[model samples]
Target: MLDANLKQQLQGLLTNLREPIELVSSLGDDAKSVELASLLDDIAALSDKVSVTRADDDARRPSFLIRRASDAQVAVRFAGIPMGHEFTSLVLALLQVGGHPPKVAPEVLEQVAALDGDYHFETYFSLSCQNCPDIVQALNLMSVVNPRITHTAIDGGLFQAEVEDRKIMAVPTIFLNGETFGQGRMELEQILAKLDSGAEAKAAEKIAAKDAFDVLVVGGGPAGAAAAIYAARKGIRVGLAAERFGGQVLDTMGIENFISVQHTEGPKLVAQLEQHVKDYDVDIMNLQRAEKLIPAKTEGGLHEVKLASGASLKARTVILSTGARWRQLGVPGEDEYRNKGVAYCPHCDGPLYKGKRVAVIGGGNSGVEAAIDLAGLVAHVTLIEFDSELRADAVLQRKLASLPNVKIITSALTTEVLGDGEKVMGLSYKDRNKDELHQIELEGVFVQIGLVPNTEWLKDSVTLSRHGEIEVDHRGETSQAGIFAAGDCTTVPYKQIVIAMGEGSKAALSAFDYMIRLPADVEAEAA
Candidate 1:
C-alpha cells in the first residue's frame, strides 16, 4: 500500500500531465500481479489524465504498457512490477510519454537530439538496484528526445529466461543494438560517448597516440580528481586516466557524512565532482583504464602508464588513486540471487525491504553501520559476524546494540544464500564455535564484508600490502620515487571521501615537491 505522503506527492506530480496516458496491464493471477494492479488503480484514480486497462496475455505477464492517448506510436513497456527504486523510472517514463521533457542538461539534450540511426537499448535490472533507475531513465529520456532511439527496461526476476539467455550476471546490464553495451551505472555523457563512438573503434583511436604530462593521476574518484586539480593549480600539465570518473562513489546512495551538505546522492555528487574537475586545466580522459605501470628508466625520468585501451601516457610523477569495490562472499546461491534479494549496498537497496526482515553479513564498521541504517527501514535486522566480537567502533557498536529490532550473532559464518531461483528467501550460516549450521528466513541479505582494492595493475610497479592495497607513506608517496598512492586503494586507514580528497592533495603536493628536487634538465622536460 502506498503511504499517504507518497500518494499526495504522486497526485501533485500527475496533475501536471499535459496529455492523457493509458496503462495497459498484462498481469497474471499472481500475488505480485494483484498488488501491482491495485497500485496502478490507485495511481489512475489520482488524476483525470491517467487511465488503466486490461491487455491480452499474448505478451509477457506481469507487464505494463504506458502510452500517450494522442500518439499511437508510443510503445514504452515495463516488464515487471515497478516497485522499490524502479518506481522512479515508471514515473519518469510516464512524464516523458505525456509530453514532458526530461530534466537533463541542455548540452546533453542537444547531443541526444542530434543523434542519428536507430538505437535500441534493452536494460535489464532488479527493483533493488539503486543504480539501475539512473541508466533506465537516461535511456528513456534519450528515446524521448529522438525517435531513432528506443529503450525498454526488463526486470531480471520476471524475465529469468531472457536473463539466462543473455548470461547476465549483474543488474543494470544494458544491451545496445542487440549486443551488450555496458554494466552497472553510467553517466548520460558517457553513454552518449559510447554510442557516438563505436566502443572498439573509439578505444583504438584514443590509444593511437601517447600523451605526456607532468603529473598523471590514475582513477577518477574523489582522490584522483582532487590530485589532478591540486597538481593543475601548480601550473603543470596534468592528465587523468580513469575507467569511470566517480569510481565506487557511483555505487553509493545517500551520503550525509560528506561535511557541509546535509544530504546528497551518489550521482549528484559525481556530477559535481566531474564539473569541478573540468573547471581545472586538467586533461581528463574518461573510460580509459590503466592496465600496467612502467617505472622510469632513470632517476627523475618520465614513467609510463599503460591503459587498457592500448594507450599509454608518460608523466614525471603519478598518483595512484584506483579505488576499491565491495567484497563478495563466494558462497552458493549468492551469485544466483544477486539483485533478486542479495544486495551489497545498504543505502541503495534498504528502502526496498521496508517492513521486511533482512540480515547483514559481517560485523565490521561498514556492516554494523549498515545494520543500524537498515534497522530504521526494515522490520527486523540480524547482524551476523564471523568474529566473536564486532569490529565496528565502540560508538557504532553501542548504537547497533541499542536497536531493539536488530539481533547480533557472533562467530557465525555465512554458508549459502537460500533462494527460490528467482529471489532470495533466506540464508544459511554456520556457528563457527559450535560447528552447527542454521538457516534464517528473510527477504533480503546485505553483504558488507569489506572492500577489495583495485591495484592489480600496479603490483609490479609499486609496493603493496599483503591484501593488495598500495603501500604509501604519510605524504602518500609509494615505493617508486616519483609515484604516489592514495584513497581506498592505498594503505590509508579510512575509506571516506574527505580522507581520500585530503590524501589526494597530499599526494599532489608530494609529487610537486619531488619534481622541484629534480635536476634542472629533468624538471625542464617535465614542465
Candidate 2:
C-alpha cells in the first residue's frame, strides 16, 4: 500500500505526463504479476495518460513494455519488478518516454548518437546498492538517445541463474555483449571511453611496464584525496590508485556532521573531493586496485605496488588510505530484499521511508545514532541489538532514550528479513534470553553493525592489527620505513572525514620528510 505522503509525491510527478504509456505484462500465473498489476493500476489511476495492457506472448511474461501509445517501437522494457530504489528508475523511464529527456550533457548526447555498432548493455543490480541507480539511469538514457544502443537493468536476485553464469559477486556489474564490461558505479564518459577503445583488455595487457613516482597514495577516499593534494603541493610527482574515487562516501546520503556546510549528500561531496584533487597536478588513476605491496631492496629504493590490472607502479614513498566498507547482515531474505526494504545507509535512503516503520540492526554508536537520526524522518524506528545492552556511548544512549518514536530491543538476533517477492514488509528475530521468535512489521531495515577496513592486500607487507587494519604511528608512519598509513584502514581510532583528512596531510608531510633525508645517491637518481 502506498502511504499518503508517497502517493502525493507520485501524483505530482506523474501529473504532467505528455503521452499515454502502456504497461504490457504477460505474467499470467506468476506471483509478481499481481504486485506489478496493482502498482501499474495505481500509477494509471494517477494520470489520464497512463494505462496497462495484457500481452499474449509468454516469452516476455514478466517484462514491462513501456512506450508511447502512438509509437510502434517500445521506448523501454523492464524485465523484472522494479520495486525498492528501482521504483525511481521506472518513474524516470516513464518520464523520458512521455517527452521528457534526461539531463545529460549535450556533448555526451552527440557522442552517443554518433556510435555505429550494435551495443547491448545488461546491468545487474541489487535494490540495496546505492551505486546501481546512477549506472542504470545513465545507460537507460543512452538507450533513449541512440537507437544503436539498448540497455536492460536486471535485478540480481530474481535472475540467479544469469548472475551465476556471469559469476557476478557485486552490484552494478555491467555486461557489454555478454562479457564483463565494468563493475561498480561508473561515469558515462568512462563507459563511452571503454567502448570506443577496448581499454579494459588493453589495461590488462600493458602491465609489464612500470610507472614511477615520488609519492604513491592508495585508495581514492577522503584520506587518499587529501594525501594526493598535499603531496602535489610539494611540487613532486605523486600518483593515486583507487578502485573507486569516493570510497564509502559514495553510499552515504545525508551528512549533517561533516561540519561547515550544515548538510550535504555523499555523491555531492565526492564530486567536490574529486574536483579538488583534479585541480592539483596529481596523477589520478581511477578503477585500479592495489593487489600487493613490495618493499624496496635497499634504503630509499623504489617500492613496487602491483595492481589487479597486472600493472605495477614504483614510488619512493607510499601512504595507505584505503577506507572501510559497511558490514552486512548475513541473514535470509536480506540479500533478496536489499534496496527493496533492506538498506545499509540511513542517510541515503531514509527519506524514502517517510511516515513508515523501519528497523535499525546494531546497538553500537552507529546503530544508536542511526536510530536517533531516523526517528525524526520516519514514523517509527525499532532498533534491534544482539547484545543484552547497548554498547553506544552514554551521550548517544541518552539521545536515543529521548526519542518517543524509537524502540530499542536488546538480546535479539535478527534471523531473516520478511518480504514479498517484490519488496520487504517485515523481519523476524529470535530472543536470546527467552528462546522465542519475534516479528516486526516494517517497511525498511538499516544495518549499522560497523565497518570492515580494506587492508587485506597489505597484510603481507605491513604490520596489521588483529582486525586486519593497518598499523601506524602518531605521525602516520607505518611499521616499514618510507611507508605511511592513514584513514579508516589504519589503526586510527576515529573514522571521521575531518580526522582522515588531517591524518592524510600528516602522512604526506612525513613522506616529504623521508624524501628530503634520502641518501645522496638515491636523491640524485630521483632528481
Candidate 3:
C-alpha cells in the first residue's frame, strides 16, 4: 500500500503528461501474467485523454498530437522513462498532463497565472542523483498555468557533449531567462518572481545600469573565482558578481579530497581562492545578483549583464562558473540542527564527525560514498533511506556492504532530528514497509542525497534542458550569441571541485576566444 503522500505525488505526476497517451503492453497467457494484465487494464482505464482533433491530418496524422488546445484547456504531460527515483517523476508528469492545479495557494497561483509573456525553461540533471524529481515537477507546475512557458529536461548522462559544452556539473539546475536566478529545488514564489515580466524587467534595468567591465563572471565559489583568476591573468578587466563571496563552499567544515590540498578547511580554501582572484586586477562585486543578461546589438559585440541593484555591466564576454550545491532533507529539525550537527556535504564535513556516531541520509552513490568514507573515520555510521533497495552502482554497493561499522537501514523515513542545545544527539524515524517506528542515537547526520545546479536565472534566455541546465557546445557556447556558461551550472558530468575548476577554465578560454574575435570598436570600448 502506498502512503498518502506518495499516492498524491504519483497522481500529480500523471497530470503532467500531455494528452492522448496510451499504454501499450506485450502480454503472455499465464496465471501471473493474467494478474499483471488485469492491473494494466485498470491503469489504462484510469488514464485521461486530452483530445485535439486535426482537420488537415484527419486521416493520416498521429492521434497523440492533434490540434493545439484553446485558452481554457488544461495541458497534459507525457510520462516516460520510469526508472529508480525517476519513476516518481513519471507519475508527476502524468499529473501535469492531467492538468491538476498546483497545490500552491490560490493567491500565489493567481499572481503567477497573470503572466502573459514567454518563459523558456531548461533543467539539467544526472540520473544518478535522487533529487531531480522535485525540481522537475516544480518546473512542470510552472508550465501548467503559463502556456507561454516551455520546459525541457536534459539528462546529463545521455547528452554528455551538450552537458560538457554547457559545463554542467550537478543535477536539478534551473535557469530563468538568460541568467541564473536560483539553484536546486526552488519555492513557487522564487519561480514566480523570475516569471514576472514587470519585476524582472525592472531588475534587468537595474543590472544594466552598473559600470561596465571587459568580462563579467557570476558565482564566487571555486569555479567563479577560478574563472576570475584566469580571466585576470589574461590582462582583461574582469568583474566577479556573486550574492555571497564564498558561495556554498563556506558552509563546509573541511575539504580534504581536493587534489594538491592535503588537508584544509572549506572556509580557508575559499578565502585563499578569493585572495587569489583579488590579488589580480579583477574587480569583485560581492553581495550582488546577476539578474539578467542582454546580448550586444552588433555582430560580435559586447554583452550587457544586469544586477539586482539596478546596476548593469557591459562586457566583451561573459563566463558563468556557478557551481553545484548540496540538497537538504527539509524534514523537521533539519533547519534547526544545521551546523549544530546536520550537514549536506560529506566530502566537506565527514572528518568533523570523526570518532562520533553519524547517520547518512540517501541510498545512491553519494550516500554510499559518504557512508563508506564515514565508516573509516566515525565510530558508527547508520545509513537511512526511504527506499527499500540501494540505487547506487553495483561496485559502490559492494564496497558499502564490505564496511563493518556501516549499518544500512532501508525503507526508513527520518521524521525528526533529536538534538540538544549545543549539538545533535539522536533521530526518530519510521519504516515504510511496516508501521514500526524506530530511533537511532547519533551525533551527526550527513545529507548525501544529491546536488542541485545553480542555474535558475537563465530560463528565458537560452535553450536549457528540461531540468534548467544551460545548453552549451563542446566549448561552452550557450544558445545565445556572445554568452557562455560553465562549471556546475552547465551539464557537466562530475560535480567535483576539480572538475568545476577545469570547466571554468575552459569556459573562460572560450569566452576569451569570443572576445578576441569581436569587432574592434565594441571590444575597445568594453576594454
Model 3: lDDT equals: 0.66
Model 2 C-alpha lDDT per residue in residues 402-423, reported as the tens digit of each score: 9899998999999999988867
TM-score of 1: 0.74
lDDT of each: 0.85, 0.82, 0.66
Task: Arrange candidates, best TM-score first.
Answer: 1, 2, 3
Enumerate clash totals for all models, in the order shown. 0, 3, 78
Task: Put down candidate 1 lDDT per residue, 206-293, tens digits, no spaces.
Answer: 6556467889999999999899989999999898888988999888767889999889877678879988988999988778878999
Listing every candidate in turn, what is its Cα RMSD in Å to the true structure after a full C-alpha superposition? 6.0, 8.8, 21.1
Considering only N, C-alpha and C atoms within 3 Å, which residue pairs clash in candidate 2? 127-339, 128-338, 128-339
Q: Is candidate 1 or candidate 3 better by TM-score?
A: 1
Better of 2 and 3 by TM-score: 2
Better TM-score candidate (1, 2)? 1
Ranking by lDDT: 1, 2, 3
Highest-scoring model, TM-score: 1
Local distance difference test, candidate 2: 0.82
